[model samples]
Target: MSPLPLHAVAIGDGLTDPATQVLTKPQQAFAFGLVDEKQLAQAQALAQEAHDLALAQRYADAADKRSAMEDLVPLGARNLPEA
Candidate 1:
């Protein structure tokens, strides 16, 4: 028989959860010396754009994986007959 499948898993448990995801906006603002109004606005905008792009990419990837699994389920089911 073939060896058991070893599925890859994320390192951290809840740390990767959306609720716990880190917000680098404030930190970026502080790093960029956001004491001035203009600078603060610019930094906040940049951070927001970056965060949105990252979230979009994550969702796209998840959808792609889910679509791929549609094919895998039938094959897996075929491997196991009724109990």
Candidate 2:
């Protein structure tokens, strides 16, 4: 018995170049799978770094706003108008 022509099989530690072939749909799929895996990993790492930076900036901004509000509180003339 032999493997079917269109059957999907896993390559085990093979030295196949994923982006060098375009013969069948399965080959294209395999290439895209490799590219997508790499792209997704990179995107995930970038997202995590962006999220950390955003969180740090937000915290710093909140602290600055709090300090500004505290300084204004001592003036007593910046109170809200009566409603």
Candidate 3:
């Protein structure tokens, strides 16, 4: 028998409905210095691809693309560890 398909858990729960959530933009990171436009463009492409994959119900692939896009950007100061 085929195994059951696995899906990602919804973004929020209970009080927050996933359907009501609106994504104005994809993930973005703030850098301490100048950021590369080429990397930004690449990340944007990945974001669009991820959105398309999610719409096609390829959740895992979409998440992978999102992770790749995230890796292109540096973490913001707020997310950095203290020295």
Top-lDDT structure, candidate number: 3
| Cα lDDT, model 3, residue 73 | 57
After superposition, candidate 2 runs with Cα above 4 Å error: 1-35, 58-83
Question: For model 2, how does the per-residue alpha-carbon lDDT over 27-77 read when each residue is reduced to its tens digit?
Answer: 232244532554444433433443444456654544343334323222443
lDDT by residue for model 3 over 1-83, one digit each (tens)? 99879776763333242111112123233233323667667766776777777778887887787777766756652232211
Cα lDDT tens digits for candidate 1, 1-83 = 99988898656333353311323333433444433465445544544544555577765544343333222223333122111
Would you list the clashing residue pairs of candidate 2? Answer: none
Computed on alpha carbons, the lDDT of every model, listed in order, comes to 0.40, 0.36, 0.53
Worst 10 contiguous positions by lDDT, candidate 3: 17-26
Each candidate structure's TM-score, on Cα atoms with residue i matched to residue i, is: 0.33, 0.28, 0.53
- How much does candidate 1 score in TM-score? 0.33
For all predictions, the C-alpha RMSD in Å is 17.9, 25.6, 10.5
Better of 1 and 2 by lDDT: 1
- Clash totals, every prediction: 0, 0, 0
As for lDDT, the candidate ahead, 1 or 3, is: 3
